[model samples]
Target: MIGKLSSKEGVVNVLVSWLPLEDNWYARILDENLTILSLYETGDILLANHIKLENFVIKNILKLSAIYCYCGNSLSTKAYGLAHDQIRKCLFDMNYDKSDIVFNTNSAQLCSECDANFDRVNLPEDFKKNLKKDLKKLKKDFFYRVYDFVQTKPKISIVIATIFALFINILSNYLYEIIMGRANLPIFLVSPFVVIWNYFT
Candidate 1:
């Protein structure tokens, strides 16, 4: 009934909001072209997860493509029975758990099985192929990308951080020597590791 608010006809309209739908699953397909997305949580739903609304919405649009292609414009819950049983990070995963949405939101695509199903869809030529390539756009922001890199490569991050600190410390000490015409730098200005080693000795 919420879809009735739109005055425009013959156009696909997807209205999204934080509405209390049944079970509050990630999104509900009201119609083939109209889907109402559920974002009913404050934290761990979007902002806390470092997910931008724009990227989230774009990802949902991709999901809808595969959904409608297989389901054939039906709004029935059973129409999506072909969804995968496990979370394969596919666009067709049955996300009974709301947290599972993060999987699709972060660099997910249609599984090979589901992509093969596109042959049955009456979509334009290469539509499904284009959608596959478009999945790269649904990535986490720069900060989260860097955070994930650090998480996966902690040793590399530590080494880089140590090198950066040493470079900055030496540059500061040299600048101080030139400005004050002094031959040496203060202990704290030299390097934290040097101070720690001297204290230990």
Candidate 2:
């Protein structure tokens, strides 16, 4: 499905898709004119077919300024962090600044990079306002779901759980670097949940 937000300069098109076999939800950005701009995809997808990404980005470099990549969630964590980092670095190498890039925890969340500077960007004031409202609702819904799942958990338990999650996140990132042969920040570290869970199981 495609969702769009308009700005005075252009419209930002959010294209969302799901990979049933891999259980990955992917979102990409396109300009107001329906011209493809950002090409952020799942790490697994990029690794499997990087050449296409390379060519597409190269062709649209002029029109592409900012990008938002969705890192995997608890039920599934692949190489999204690694893949996003690589793509951003590649864009940087091609002359895009680090600030031009942004990331979201999942399809439900707004782009942290873009949200922080919403007023400064070309996006319409109404769209930006609505996005902020949507983000709040999404966070609230997510919190309620988590709270229900782990009801009556002690404060200390929450603390310990958080620490353990960080530990595993760091370790998993290290393992991904070693396995993927690229040293970069773990993609999901910025997210609330750090554990990579299995959806197929």
Candidate 3:
């Protein structure tokens, strides 16, 4: 579950949790003083399903009722607090007007104000082309970051295993020499035993 709080001043606080055996659920409420708002939810799927809903809360309080209905069936009451905290943090970090963001269950878009402002920028043809080129470069950079993050775990494991295997081979040969009074064992015989011991140990 994840939770968040947002204030009219644009401050946000976030919290998250995971419980495998629990159902998913969420809720948002105006602060008792009505000076702030909160959104919260619980469930394994809550984060993925309710992210857009959080955006909606930032846009409209009425949308909170709708999101509550959509997520109520899948999450527990405990999840709501976690969801609220996470949403709050996101809102606090955002630099734009909260109302300028709109949520879609299937897709999201900027509010009309943002759309109007964007259109008013009125870039020249060359500037638009340059912007596109920059966006493509940004996408390529993001892709590489994701690729490296995903590849790191497997690569580290492989390197560690190779080094460990080598270490065990050396240790086994030293031990065999000690036991047999310095007679060298065949590489094949020593290597197989080293691999088996490395794995089992």
Candidate 4:
């Protein structure tokens, strides 16, 4: 099914197919302007919200875009072996296992080697920086981001949540005193639900 895909000038063409690629790859960059994405056995990825396929498509797009912008057709190969199985959450992670794509998508950063390589590239000044920022943005949903943050730093998360709750309490108390006129901050603090219910009734 991938045979009909033909590369075009001044464009990036990605062919998404269900046929298994050689070496069980999720995707492969055939040329600077062409990539092959396979859906075969993609269900094994075990990613959040069925993000495996989308991640593959975005990964190829961004990777090839950076390479093309950096050196046009002068760059020898795609950004595949740059990570060399390091799994450093870098945009160019080899991810030979394919499932490691999950890590590459979220928390992706430019490794020192790749960073230095980009420094020598032909792109404009901020291209690599923007690429890093964009790659980092391709992470899990907001709920999972907060969940992971709290899981990783329980104490800090608790402190931040407590501070937010306290600030909300203070703001609500002041607003209530202004709006309701007779509602004291002390009364609101003691039984907020009772005060609100009593006021309405």
Candidate 5:
């Protein structure tokens, strides 16, 4: 199982685990001796794995200077499945301990004291509402940061396109001068007409 432990306020120790089961998964959080705890799970542990993979991909994309659409799309699916299986194996090895478990499936809830901590578990409507608010704030913050950066720098795409167009224009002009022997007409005049003719014919 994948586990992380941290201490808060020098008194409360938190352990989080993603545990694999014979046919399912478990996630538990516990204090020392697994006495005070929280657990979550469903028979289908694969859902948690899916979330983990999606989170990873989003983080990866955020770090990239440019996103390759095809590669990102292809890797996302594979990464999700692989993360699920790997987390399952990790949880299995941890023996589903409770004292230090944090994130896990929603199917089962057990504290370190072996008491049912999630017997009254239900989806909190307010949780989603709050989460949406936080997400919107985060999205706004990201866009604002990106806008600030763009304002301070030249756009890479525009710069690249301009250079490309200049190269093509120079090459075509050179070719025309070589073939036509510098006919007294302006290069721009001949170039546009040539482009139009090539497009239609």
Candidate 6:
């Protein structure tokens, strides 16, 4: 059993299972209550694409009260498991004081609890589609955060300068034709005037 929900009546427990990928393991999220709020085993997509799995859980399962992660024998070691310290650090980063989670090895006795009757429950048709959209948004948000972090440094000025140079290149020909009225003015000479004009306007 895990912690109680905010309602004190609706108990939410997330059960995690590890899937063997090519090199790394993928995790699947399943609520013990047989809810349709589950994410697919994204393999290395989460870590490789820099998607924030913790944010996904927090946004999609805002009402979750607890999480129960069951790992196989391979991940039974203290340093490696579905709910290891590395994962727990991210999960507990928010206001998780009211909720709790437990991780245990998949021993013979634990197999009984791990066997969830997922066939009986039919997920909605749009469940996977919605999950895909949410995942794309998560990846986008992660990149935006990374960009925000890097933008505060002095190196970002070089990026802005490069973009400005490209913008000037794109408009150089047109500005030259308009300025000389014969489409024969040198772009190098007209570019500075265009920049000054646009800046003043």
- Most accurate candidate by lDDT: 1
| Candidate 1 error regions (>4 Å) | 1-10, 42-44, 71-79, 159-201
Instruction: Report how far residue 178 has shifted in candidate 5, in Å.
Output: 0.7
Using lDDT as the yardstick, the better of models 1 and 2 is 1
- The local lDDT score (0 to 100) that residue 157 gets in candidate 2 is 64
Give candidate 3 misplaced runs (Cα > 4 Å).
Answer: 1-152, 183-201
Q: How well is each residue in 1-201 modelled by candidate 5, as lDDT tens digits?
A: 222222221222223333343333332222221211113353123233233322222222221101111123111222222122222312112333432222322111223221121122332335323422332332223554455455666587468669999999987887788678874666866899999999999
Model 5 deviation from the true structure expressed as Cα RMSD, one decimal place:
19.5
Give the per-residue lDDT of model 4 (tens digit) for 129-175: 78877776676667877887899999999999999999999888887
Worst 10 residues of 4 by lDDT: 1-10
CA lDDT, candidate 5, residue 156: 70
Against the true structure, candidate 6 reaches a TM-score of: 0.29
Reference-based TM-score, model 4: 0.68
* Consecutive 10-residue window with the lowest summed lDDT within model 2: 68-77
Work out the TM-score per prediction: 0.67, 0.27, 0.23, 0.68, 0.18, 0.29
Candidate 3 lDDT tens digits, 105-179: 112233443233335544334533342233223112355445545577778767877999999998888888868
Candidate 2: misplaced stretches above 4 Å? 1-15, 20-25, 30-32, 35-116, 139-201
lDDT of 1 at 114: 75
The total number of steric clashes, by the backbone 3 Å criterion, in model 2 comes to 1
Off-target runs (Cα >4 Å) in candidate 4 are 1-9, 41-46, 49-56, 69-79, 124-126, 182-201
Model 1, C-alpha of 187: deviation from truth (Å) = 38
Q: What is the Å distance of residue 106 in model 5 from its true position?
A: 30
Q: In model 4, which residue pairs have backbone atoms overlapping below 3 Å?
A: none
- For candidate 3, the lDDT comes to 0.37
Candidate 1 collision pairs = none
- List model 1 lDDT by residue over 89-152, tens digit each: 8877777777777777777777877776777668656877788788877788898989978999
